[model samples]
Target: MARPTFRELTAQALSSVEHGYDLLAPKFDHTPYRTPDRVLNATVRVLRPYGPFGTGLDLCCGTGAGARVLRAVCRKRMTGLDFSAGMLDRARSAAPDGTWVRGNALALPFAPGSFDLVVSFGAHGHFLPRERPRLFAAVRTALRPGGRFAFPLAAPARPGTPAYWSLLAFDTAMRVRNAVWRPPFVMYYRTWPLTDVRRELRAAGFGVTLHPLSELGVRPDGSPRCRLVLATRLPEHSG
Candidate 1:
């Protein structure tokens, strides 16, 4: 299938959140912005060796993309959680077998040590840097001791490429929009840098590791353009 044009996708993205996604939901699967199946398959491949996890959760599981990944890795039960009713509606249609919940990431409804594994895809930009520790801690409290929370993080855009400039413009525009608009549409491409993310995860009681998705290939600098960040809660905390 031919991918949707960038203009069409951008048009939907710029509208109000619910209305924008309600419009995009129908064609979202055909867009590059939808977590690529290659990335999903690669994540499943890496997670397979370690899992057979009992219960799994997909946070901000837009259209159930990460739920599909968890379905392959988890053994018993799986769930997809998101705040967007439009997104959840699409996700429910895609994965009828998995549980779906609508709620905020900062205060997940599950009790402490509830899930064995939790994963999210392409949802971090919706959160600001300061909100990360709370988000990570919430995920940690929802997981069992030694439970793993994982997600893919791509390398930063290179300084002068069109991709880089495009992202900068988009983020700048979002800032301007938020200044003039109400209930800000919180998305920024450059805010959640990986180094800052790692520190926040550690502060949230997780020991983190990085695994290169070598299948995605390397950048001009010979570094992997895509990698997974696996953050596991420690079994015990030191005083």
Candidate 2:
């Protein structure tokens, strides 16, 4: 966030979401928009047991943080796909060894069963709830039979807590901004509940499973702070 100056942030806020990302791409790594290294590291460790995966895909790879997970786990080719040309340029430059694809997540440009593993991070907020089914279907289609799609989801903060209020305020602000703005920047903090997401994934043909990311620890109630959603594309003959 600090990477973009006030003028730059204002410009992005006033622009459409896609163009906003394009504007922010060069300095995205220095901003909070970039996925944290810790989250990426934790994912690598958590997924190591589930993988020794062949080909891998990183969906909506902003600047290739999740590509590290693909690189670590996959034995074969690694690919990063994103809608933003500026972001894809940065990803390609940063991770030269991997393939960089510029395309929409809702309609992934790949053959069916193209990848053994697929991972996305911090991109769910951009998709409205109604769009999730299509988005997930694309991911499901891109994966091989028995391929796994994974991402981290945090437990909702308790009501009246600072985190809860902060997210509420952000969502409210976004709603108001969209209502008044010419082109809306669709970002929501609280829309993607785990139960709803799981249902959507299941509807899209994934067998959903949850793995608590122990490295991030649990909240006071002992619920994990975050858990990884491991959704597998079932094989044709599997019971």
Which one wins on lDDT?
Answer: 2
Give TM-scores for every candidate, taking all chains together and pairing residue i with residue i: 0.92, 0.96
Deviating ranges (above 4 Å) for candidate 2: 236-239
RMSD of each: 2.2, 1.6
Q: Across residues 1-239, which tens digit of lDDT does each residue of candidate 2 receive?
A: 45889899889888898899899998889877788888888899889998899999999998888888998999999999988889989998989999999888999999999999999999988999999999988888899889999999989989999999999999999999999997999889898999999988887888999988888889998889999999999765542
Q: How accurate is candidate 1 locally (lDDT)?
A: 0.86
Error of 2 at 179 (Å): 1.0
User: All candidates' lDDT scores?
Assistant: 0.86, 0.90
Instruction: For candidate 2, give the lDDT of residue 163.
Output: 98
Residue 95 accuracy (lDDT) in model 1? 87
Model 1 bad stretches (over 4 Å): 1-19
lDDT of 1 by residue, 182-235 (tens): 646787889878899998888788898999999899999899999999998986
